[model samples]
Target: MKIAIISPGPFSVPPVKGSSVEHDIDEVTKMIDPEHQVTIYTRTCATYPKSAVEENRQFIRFPYNGPKPYLRRIISHIRKRKPDVIMVENRPIYVLTLKRHFPKIPVFVNMHSHVYGSPGMISKDKMKKVVRRASGFFTNSEFLRRHFMKTCKIPAHKIHAVHLGVDVSPYQVAKIHYSIRKIRKEIGLKPEDRVLFYAGRLMRAKGVHVLLKAFKEVCEQDPLARLVIVGGTGYGSNRLNPYVRELKQLAKPLGDKVKFVNFVPSAQMPLYYQVGDIVATPSVWKEAFCRVNLEAMASGKPVITTPRGGIGEVVTHQGSGFLIPPKDWKAELPALWKLLWSAPSIRTEMGKNALMRAKQFSWYATAQGYLEVFETALKKRKAASPPTKQDLRKTG
Candidate 1:
């Protein structure tokens, strides 16, 4: 099948850093069956070319001056390509427009977050139209599927839940152990330090401030406890803001116990994962499906995160990792930190279980899930389509 995938338009396909939706698109496209011809429509970057082909996939880049221009460029190319199906990533409005232009073609939208589907972003009437017009809808988690059903009144049958995945090869135990010592030394982490890692946007919604408060308590109790905060205020952005300044103020009391590493590239994330004894993604917001949890599990480290949204689906409570409720994080985080720090056996066991669980969610599985949705949608479209002139002639 010839597949056309439309990116969210804000970020490049192989995202520079910090766009999980783009990262997911890039990974899934790479893992898709070689027999299928895949074409990706994404925003152009200075580092990338206008168009390029790799294996069975082709990438077409367009300048994203605004949403109108980007859509115009993609629509022009898509009309020429006439792919078997079209998959719009993280943009519900695009599905409505694309389906209007190419009514016969099955256009599907994949919702990666609640931001686009909310009533604030798109009206209830338009969302209803999207549900009625689009061939199918895909979400990163069951939580999000239910969310759309409630918000947009979409039918259960129209929405399908396809979980995101991680590339577990680089995070294998042997590879991590080999480079961990060097990485730790370079980061000035002492051998005795029990590092607690946080990698995501340094925003209050992500619960970074909450984590800092909890970590401050942990540090007072355990001299070896350390916290490493990764990522910037936004994707590909490390510039300081009010929230960042506030975070610094919060961390000041803890002093050198907290180290902030701003905006590491996605390619080098595996190395950063190795530097952590445990990974924490204390997001207070309902994350659709966080790749950080998967990456940490794949790295053979137990994650301490809230069970909000699809995180519960990814991290098993007390089995693979600890899932503290967002409200209880202030009280529970320090306690869990102490438990994991004091008991090496429990941490090791959970880490092993985490690695095992991580194996089930691979890029291959993610790609196959997407292909199944596309194929099913295409088949349904063909079945419902009107008979061609050739079919009438054959009957005559």
Candidate 2:
């Protein structure tokens, strides 16, 4: 099967950092069978050449001048390659363009989360039109799938859910123990400090302020408790923004107990997991599926996340980690204390369980799942009514 995956415009293939969706695309493309040819169309960056091929996978870049120019470039490229199935990540608005030029091809939109609230993306009405017209829709979590279905009035059969995955090898318990102390020291963590790690965007919606508030309470109860924030302004931005400033101000009272490492490369994230006693992702909004939880679990560390969106699907409450309700620090405080300040044996057992659970999700499995969706959608598209010349000319 020939596949063309269109990633979001913010980053290129083999993302250095802050491109979780692209990373997902890269990982899945790598594990795909050699018999199947894969071409990933991503945004061009200074680091990447126009075209590069590795193994069965090929990467092609296009400039992100604007939606009009981007769509024009995409149409020109796809007309040449004419892939069997086209899979686009996020940005539901792209479906209109694909349908206009490649009416015969099956197009699947893999949504990480709904972007309705985000600035300058497609509107809800446009997204609904995309959902109705596309061959199929997929989301990283069931929560996202259900939400999309309900919001767009699409049938359940049109949407599928595949949990996000992590490369569990580097985060194995053996590897973590090998450099535990060294990584801890490198991150400015003392031997006695019990670190709570948070790795994602520093935006308030991600619950950074809430995490700081909860950490302040934890520190008041236990001075040895520490919080390590490991992210910049997410979505490929390198510079610190006002949100980062706000978080810094929030953590000021807590002083050096809160450590901000800015943006750590995705390749080096395992070290942060190893140094943390517990991973916290207290997102106020409903996340589709957070890769941070999977990475932490793979590294043999317990995670304390909110019970919103697809998080419930990823975490088993009190089994692998605690799932506290979002923004309810009253509930969050106790859970944090229990995991971080309580018995060492409890944390150890939970970490062991987390590692076991993490093994269930793998990039290979995710890739295979995506292939199944592509095949099913393609077959369905083939069986449906033939595309009329009128359909090909229709552009919205």
Candidate 3:
């Protein structure tokens, strides 16, 4: 059961900031059998030592001097410490390297999201080749599985749709230390104020701007409504990013009705969700799974999100929460205004529904699903190609 998770050369495992892919890798690795050896390959610019082991898992971080240097370092490490299976995060180009060098080793290319931005470095044809060669593909949502099948022409059997799960303990209703009264008082929210929370990167694609625009209209009509944004620039970068600047401009006219809190640590995120009456993830782009929705649902708050990609799979329309059409903030406005202005009993009922729905997803369940995929891929690889003299020598 030895596993090697190859992370993209941008972030570390158990990402200190916002990295859904790295966070999933960290969680799944922890859920795997402690008897099995699991190692993660990360990229870092820090001056710390190159390798470290913690929590029954090993991490080998390589310096990101340049593409060539990083690739050389990664190749060197993989050659020396080959694992029973290779599980790679997104960025198919890197997996192509493993396929080229260790063709027999079963490789699983897990797709977290396809809409992170441009894939400027890797050509389309080369990426398709990587998809075709992978022993199996893991997608976080059924929407993404279909996308891969359509775009890559990968066989349906090769793709597995396993939804991501949230760490629900911190968000449990009884386990939470911060009560609604304390959270509201700390945030300067009045007893009568209604809060709409958004906790994610301030990037435009995340639909922060859409939320701001809709909130402005909602606030104009309902002065008691407030929007609380809790996240800074993504990818652990502290610099004042352009998206942050743009979001500020969009929120300027709205004044203090819109509050922006810089990146809150993962441990304290539950407080923000507990304080708010509603969680709004107005993302314009098609999210693969929309972890924010699940986190909010776990925190016992209904979400008003778009029915893009796998988001519909998580949030039921008017059941646990309301699902709006993508990029249709105008449509979102009426629903948000109605919900924010609704009676306390109505909101509470929806929150109860959200909590019930959130209970169905768990990190342990997600880990088991991934292990099943790994076992199946290994079985398929063994049947397709028995060990040859070269593979046997390499194993020896």
Q: Model 2 scores what on Cα lDDT? A: 0.82
Candidate with the larger TM-score of 1 and 2:
1
What TM-score fits each model? 0.96, 0.91, 0.89
List the candidate 3 regions with Cα displacement exceeding 4 Å: 44-50, 54-56, 116-121, 173-187, 238-243, 326-328, 339-341, 384-396
- The CA lDDT of each predicted structure is 0.89, 0.82, 0.79
lDDT of 3 by residue, 1-396 (tens): 778888876666667665778778887777877777888888774533568787768988887666567767877877888777888788667777778888878888888877421257567788777767888888889999898888777799988998888777778753356476786676778888888989987787788888888788787678888888888777555457777888889899988888887787665677678778789998888888989999999988889999888899999888888888755776567666675466777788888999899988877788788888888777876778878999989999
Order of candidate numbers by TM-score, starting with the best: 1, 2, 3
Distance from true location, Cα of 208 in model 3, Å: 1.9
Candidate 2, superposed: residue stretches over 4 Å from native: 116-120, 173-183, 235-240, 331-341, 384-396
How high is the lDDT of residue 336 in model 3?
A: 60
Q: Who wins the lDDT comparison?
A: 1
lDDT of 1: 0.89
